[model samples]
Target: MLANLLLEIGGSMSTLGAGIGAGLAVIGAGVGISGVGGRAMEAMARQPEIFGKLQTAMIIAAALVEGAALFAIVVCLLIAGNA
Candidate 1:
């Protein structure tokens, strides 16, 4: 009984930890993008003439952050499945 309990705990820990990591990773990306978007909007409002350049830069930055987040999620999924 003790051995079984330990095994269950160990197995659960891996998947649970991976899930937490994956969630946090995505959350961080979302927060980063939100901030970027907010700043871009503010800048656009302040300088209507520069709106196009500012928007382009903001989108590229957001995409890079989001891509990293997606990669982390994929890694977490693999880890959970293996666990």
Candidate 2:
């Protein structure tokens, strides 16, 4: 009985770990996007004439980061599923 309980607890802990990892990954992505936004804002403020180009570039960069983050999340989900 004790062994079975321990097994179940260990499995649950691993699942929790996977979820936490995914959450942290998302948080990191959010921080990265925020940084991009901040820099874009600064650039636009400094050179109002280039607002259009800066905005476009910033958005593309954010999208790429988000895509990578999503890939990590998918991997985490797969791990959780296996656990």
Candidate 3:
């Protein structure tokens, strides 16, 4: 009975951990994207002639951050499922 209780508790903890990890990942992605966008806009303001280049770079960077965040979220979900 004790073993079963411990197992259940451990499983619950794992699910909780996964949830926390996913939330943190999302928050990190948001911060990263916002920083990138703000910097890109500042750069464009400094030199409008290269607005296209700055925009392209910013989009690429933001996409990469998003991809990583998605991957992290998926991993968390997988862990939650397994637990």
Which one wins on TM-score?
3
Quote the lDDT for 15 in model 3. Answer: 100
lDDT against the true structure, per candidate, is: 0.93, 0.93, 0.97
Ranking by lDDT: 3, 1, 2
The C-alpha local distance difference test score for the whole of candidate 2 amounts to 0.93
Minimal lDDT window, size 10, model 3: 51-60
How many clashes show up per model? 0, 0, 0
What lDDT does candidate 1 reach at residue 16?
A: 99
User: What tens-digit string does per-residue lDDT give for candidate 1 at 1-83?
Assistant: 99999988998999999999899999999999999999998998889999878988999999999999999999999989987
**Clash count, predicted structure 2:** 0
Local lDDT at 77 for model 1 = 90
Write out the backbone clash pairs for model 2: none
Over the stretch 1-83, how does candidate 2's per-residue lDDT look in tens digits?
99999998988988999899899999999999999999888888899999888888998999999999999999889988988
* lDDT against true structure, model 1: 0.93
Candidate 2 wrongly placed segments (more than 4 Å)? none
lDDT of 3 by residue, 1-83 (tens): 99999999999999999999999999999999999999998888899999988888999999999999999999999999999
Q: Candidate 3 — which residues are off by over 4 angstroms?
A: none
Q: What is the lDDT of residue 15 in candidate 1?
A: 97
